[model samples]
Target: MNLTGGIVLYAVLWFLTLFILLPIGLVSQEEAGEVVPGTHAGAPHRADLGRKMLWSTVISAVLWGGCAWLILGGVFTREDVMNWDQLVR
Candidate 1:
């Protein structure tokens, strides 16, 4: 992938990882019996955004590195995936 493509890929991966990790070990206000006035009970009691971001970055970097290795190393080229039908036939 080109520079822009690589950046876009990493960004997408990072956000996806963040979303997946968002709910893990979460403490909702309702769950903790600490719902504040005018706020939804489902709201997080305390969002550890910094730690989640750090973990997301680390995990995304590893995932991006593996993908980059596969792509840059030509382990699975476009033609390889494109020829799936032919191979099956």
Candidate 2:
């Protein structure tokens, strides 16, 4: 993959990882019994975004490394992906 492709892949992986991690270990304001004024009860009592973001970066980097290895190692090519239907025959 080219530089742009690698960057895009990492970005997608990062966001996906972040979303998946977002709900884990969450504590809603209502559950914590400290709902701020005008805020939804479901709002996080302590989002801990910094820690989540750090974890996301670490996980995304590992995934990106594996993906990069696959692409660079020639395990599959663009044609393989594009002609996936033919493999069923």
Candidate 3:
């Protein structure tokens, strides 16, 4: 893949990662009943949620980074990259 392709791939991956994570963060807050305004009582759950989010963020980053590297480095051709059929088989 070219530079532009790599940028687009990275952007998409980052967006996907954030998309998956933001909801989890929201749900964690909601579960902890910390979504209400001007409240700070759920510090323990909030911290736990933050840790979960952090781990998820790190895993997503690493996975996507590896995929991007393999794709852009020509380890997999553009046609083969992210091909669900190929992966499923």
Candidate 4:
């Protein structure tokens, strides 16, 4: 893949990973019995976004590395995806 393609792929993977990780181990104010007066009960008691983001980056790097290897390696090429229907037929 080209530089832009690799960047876009990693960005997409990063956000997807972040969203996937967002709900894990979360403790909502309601669930924790500590709902603040002016906030939604479902709001996280402690989002810990910096740690989540760091983990997301690490996880996405591993995934992106695998995907990049698949794309850049000789195992598969863009042409294989583009002509998948014919290949299946």
Per-residue error for 25 in candidate 4, Å, reads 0.5
Clashes of each: 0, 0, 0, 0
TM-score: which candidate is best?
Answer: 2
TM per candidate: 0.89, 0.93, 0.46, 0.90
Candidate 1 lDDT for residue 20 = 93
Stretch of 10 with least lDDT, candidate 1: 80-89
Give, for candidate 3, the lowest lDDT window spanning 10 residues: 40-49
lDDT of 2 by residue, 1-89 (tens): 99999999999999999999999999999999999999999999998999999999999999999999999999989888999998898
Q: What is the C-alpha lDDT of each candidate?
A: 0.95, 0.97, 0.64, 0.93
**Predicted candidate 3 versus true structure: per-residue lDDT over 1-80, tens digit per residue:** 66886677666766676667654644344566656566645433444445555666677678778987776578888567
Model 1 has an lDDT value of 0.95
CA deviation > 4 Å runs, candidate 3: 27-61, 72-74, 78-89
The lDDT of model 2 is 0.97
Is candidate 2 or 4 superior in lDDT? Answer: 2
Could you list the CA RMSD of all candidates, in the order they appear? 1.6, 1.2, 6.1, 1.4
TM-score of 3: 0.46
Better of 3 and 4 by TM-score: 4
Superposed Cα RMSD, model 4: 1.4
Ranking by TM-score: 2, 4, 1, 3
Write down the worst ten-residue block by lDDT for model 4.
73-82
